[model samples]
Target: MDMDVRRAAELARIELTADEAERFGGQLGKILEYIDKLNSLDVSGVDAMAHANAVYDVTRPDESRPGFGLEKALRNAPRKTADQFIVTKVVE
Candidate 1:
Protein backbone atom coordinates (compact mmCIF):
# COMPACT_ATOMS: atom_id res chain seq x y z
CA MET A 1 0.00 0.00 0.00
CA ASP A 2 0.26 3.30 -1.47
CA MET A 3 -3.51 3.86 -1.21
CA ASP A 4 -4.68 7.10 0.42
CA VAL A 5 -6.44 5.64 3.44
CA ARG A 6 -6.61 9.02 5.20
CA ARG A 7 -8.42 10.65 2.25
CA ALA A 8 -10.76 7.66 1.91
CA ALA A 9 -11.54 7.84 5.63
CA GLU A 10 -12.22 11.56 5.36
CA LEU A 11 -14.59 10.99 2.42
CA ALA A 12 -16.39 8.28 4.42
CA ARG A 13 -16.61 10.63 7.47
CA ILE A 14 -14.53 8.23 9.57
CA GLU A 15 -11.54 9.01 11.83
CA LEU A 16 -8.53 6.71 11.69
CA THR A 17 -5.26 6.80 13.63
CA ALA A 18 -1.91 6.49 11.79
CA ASP A 19 -1.51 2.77 12.64
CA GLU A 20 -5.11 1.98 11.70
CA ALA A 21 -4.78 3.92 8.45
CA GLU A 22 -1.63 2.06 7.46
CA ARG A 23 -3.22 -1.31 8.21
CA PHE A 24 -6.46 -0.46 6.39
CA GLY A 25 -4.61 0.99 3.40
CA GLY A 26 -2.75 -2.30 2.93
CA GLN A 27 -5.99 -4.25 3.21
CA LEU A 28 -7.75 -1.96 0.74
CA GLY A 29 -4.85 -2.29 -1.70
CA LYS A 30 -5.22 -6.07 -1.57
CA ILE A 31 -8.96 -5.80 -2.16
CA LEU A 32 -8.38 -3.57 -5.20
CA GLU A 33 -5.82 -6.03 -6.54
CA TYR A 34 -8.35 -8.84 -6.28
CA ILE A 35 -10.94 -6.71 -8.07
CA ASP A 36 -8.46 -6.00 -10.84
CA LYS A 37 -7.75 -9.73 -11.18
CA LEU A 38 -11.45 -10.45 -11.45
CA ASN A 39 -11.88 -7.73 -14.07
CA SER A 40 -9.15 -9.27 -16.26
CA LEU A 41 -11.13 -12.48 -16.69
CA ASP A 42 -12.76 -13.07 -20.09
CA VAL A 43 -16.56 -13.43 -20.13
CA SER A 44 -17.68 -12.25 -23.53
CA GLY A 45 -20.42 -14.88 -23.84
CA VAL A 46 -21.71 -14.69 -20.26
CA ASP A 47 -24.90 -12.77 -19.62
CA ALA A 48 -25.00 -9.93 -17.10
CA MET A 49 -26.69 -11.07 -13.90
CA ALA A 50 -27.67 -9.32 -10.68
CA HIS A 51 -26.66 -12.32 -8.57
CA ALA A 52 -24.19 -15.19 -8.79
CA ASN A 53 -26.84 -17.88 -8.53
CA ALA A 54 -30.26 -18.14 -10.20
CA VAL A 55 -32.93 -16.44 -8.07
CA TYR A 56 -36.71 -16.20 -8.56
CA ASP A 57 -39.69 -15.11 -6.52
CA VAL A 58 -42.38 -17.70 -5.75
CA THR A 59 -45.49 -15.51 -5.64
CA ARG A 60 -49.24 -15.70 -5.97
CA PRO A 61 -51.63 -13.41 -7.84
CA ASP A 62 -53.13 -10.60 -5.75
CA GLU A 63 -56.88 -11.03 -5.21
CA SER A 64 -59.49 -8.92 -3.40
CA ARG A 65 -61.26 -10.49 -0.42
CA PRO A 66 -64.03 -9.49 1.99
CA GLY A 67 -62.96 -8.05 5.36
CA PHE A 68 -64.46 -7.37 8.78
CA GLY A 69 -66.97 -4.51 9.05
CA LEU A 70 -66.58 -1.52 11.45
CA GLU A 71 -68.96 -3.13 13.99
CA LYS A 72 -66.84 -6.32 14.12
CA ALA A 73 -63.62 -4.27 14.22
CA LEU A 74 -64.89 -2.23 17.21
CA ARG A 75 -66.44 -5.22 19.01
CA ASN A 76 -63.58 -5.37 21.53
CA ALA A 77 -63.15 -1.60 21.91
CA PRO A 78 -63.93 -0.10 25.33
CA ARG A 79 -65.80 2.79 23.58
CA LYS A 80 -66.95 3.06 19.97
CA THR A 81 -69.41 4.80 17.61
CA ALA A 82 -71.59 3.12 15.00
CA ASP A 83 -68.81 2.97 12.43
CA GLN A 84 -65.60 3.70 14.38
CA PHE A 85 -63.59 3.11 17.53
CA ILE A 86 -63.79 6.11 19.94
CA VAL A 87 -60.79 7.45 21.78
CA THR A 88 -60.25 10.49 24.04
CA LYS A 89 -59.44 13.70 22.19
CA VAL A 90 -55.85 14.60 23.11
CA VAL A 91 -55.14 17.47 20.70
CA GLU A 92 -56.71 20.88 21.27
Candidate 2:
Protein backbone atom coordinates (compact mmCIF):
# COMPACT_ATOMS: atom_id res chain seq x y z
CA MET A 1 0.00 0.00 0.00
CA ASP A 2 1.21 3.48 -0.88
CA MET A 3 1.67 5.67 2.21
CA ASP A 4 1.43 9.49 2.10
CA VAL A 5 4.23 10.41 4.48
CA ARG A 6 3.45 14.15 4.44
CA ARG A 7 -0.24 13.61 5.18
CA ALA A 8 0.56 11.11 7.89
CA ALA A 9 3.02 13.49 9.52
CA GLU A 10 0.51 16.33 9.37
CA LEU A 11 -2.23 14.19 10.92
CA ALA A 12 0.14 13.06 13.66
CA ARG A 13 1.29 16.69 14.24
CA ILE A 14 4.92 15.71 13.66
CA GLU A 15 7.32 17.94 11.73
CA LEU A 16 9.80 15.89 9.74
CA THR A 17 12.53 16.94 7.31
CA ALA A 18 12.25 15.67 3.73
CA ASP A 19 14.97 13.04 4.28
CA GLU A 20 13.47 11.97 7.63
CA ALA A 21 10.00 11.68 6.11
CA GLU A 22 11.26 9.45 3.29
CA ARG A 23 13.11 7.27 5.79
CA PHE A 24 10.11 6.96 8.12
CA GLY A 25 7.74 6.29 5.21
CA GLY A 26 9.72 3.19 4.27
CA GLN A 27 9.89 2.01 7.88
CA LEU A 28 6.14 2.52 8.38
CA GLY A 29 5.42 0.62 5.16
CA LYS A 30 7.42 -2.36 6.40
CA ILE A 31 5.60 -2.29 9.75
CA LEU A 32 2.20 -2.27 8.00
CA GLU A 33 3.29 -5.16 5.78
CA TYR A 34 4.15 -7.18 8.90
CA ILE A 35 0.76 -6.37 10.42
CA ASP A 36 -0.95 -7.59 7.24
CA LYS A 37 0.95 -10.86 7.50
CA LEU A 38 -0.17 -11.26 11.12
CA ASN A 39 -3.77 -10.56 10.12
CA SER A 40 -3.60 -13.51 7.71
CA LEU A 41 -3.11 -15.95 10.59
CA ASP A 42 -5.95 -18.08 12.01
CA VAL A 43 -6.55 -19.23 15.61
CA SER A 44 -10.22 -19.99 15.75
CA GLY A 45 -10.21 -21.92 19.05
CA VAL A 46 -7.53 -20.06 20.97
CA ASP A 47 -8.53 -18.33 24.20
CA ALA A 48 -7.90 -14.57 24.28
CA MET A 49 -5.21 -13.57 26.76
CA ALA A 50 -3.49 -10.34 27.81
CA HIS A 51 -0.06 -11.97 27.85
CA ALA A 52 1.58 -15.17 26.64
CA ASN A 53 2.95 -15.90 30.13
CA ALA A 54 1.25 -16.34 33.48
CA VAL A 55 1.03 -13.19 35.65
CA TYR A 56 0.64 -12.97 39.43
CA ASP A 57 0.80 -10.33 42.16
CA VAL A 58 3.94 -10.84 44.22
CA THR A 59 2.95 -8.56 47.09
CA ARG A 60 2.75 -9.48 50.77
CA PRO A 61 -0.57 -9.41 52.65
CA ASP A 62 -1.64 -6.02 54.10
CA GLU A 63 -1.24 -6.12 57.90
CA SER A 64 -1.55 -3.27 60.38
CA ARG A 65 1.27 -2.62 62.87
CA PRO A 66 1.73 -0.35 65.86
CA GLY A 67 2.92 3.18 64.98
CA PHE A 68 3.74 6.51 66.70
CA GLY A 69 0.96 8.12 68.77
CA LEU A 70 -0.70 11.38 67.57
CA GLU A 71 1.24 13.72 69.95
CA LYS A 72 4.61 12.25 68.94
CA ALA A 73 3.69 12.36 65.28
CA LEU A 74 2.92 16.10 65.37
CA ARG A 75 5.61 17.17 67.90
CA ASN A 76 7.66 19.18 65.34
CA ALA A 77 4.85 21.23 63.78
CA PRO A 78 5.38 25.03 63.68
CA ARG A 79 1.60 25.49 64.00
CA LYS A 80 -1.02 22.95 65.09
CA THR A 81 -4.72 22.51 65.66
CA ALA A 82 -6.04 20.08 68.27
CA ASP A 83 -5.57 17.17 65.86
CA GLN A 84 -4.35 18.75 62.61
CA PHE A 85 -1.58 20.82 61.03
CA ILE A 86 -2.29 24.59 60.63
CA VAL A 87 -0.89 26.13 57.42
CA THR A 88 -1.41 29.35 55.46
CA LYS A 89 -4.62 29.49 53.37
CA VAL A 90 -3.86 28.52 49.80
CA VAL A 91 -6.97 29.59 47.86
CA GLU A 92 -7.99 33.19 47.27
Candidate 1 has a TM-score of: 0.42
Residue pairs in candidate 2 whose N, alpha carbon or C atoms collide under 3 angstroms: none
Best-fitting candidate, scored by lDDT: 2
What lDDT does each candidate get? 0.84, 0.87
Q: By TM-score, how accurate is candidate 2?
A: 0.42
Against the true structure, what is each candidate's TM-score? 0.42, 0.42
After the best TM-score superposition of candidate 1, give how far the Cα of residue 87 lies from its true spot, in angstroms. 36
Deviation (Å) of 28 in candidate 1: 1.3
Worst 10 residues of 2 by lDDT: 32-41
lDDT of 1 by residue, 24-58 (tens): 98899998877787678899999898998889988
Tens-digit lDDT string for candidate 2 (7-70): 9889989999999998989998888877788667797898889988899879866888779888
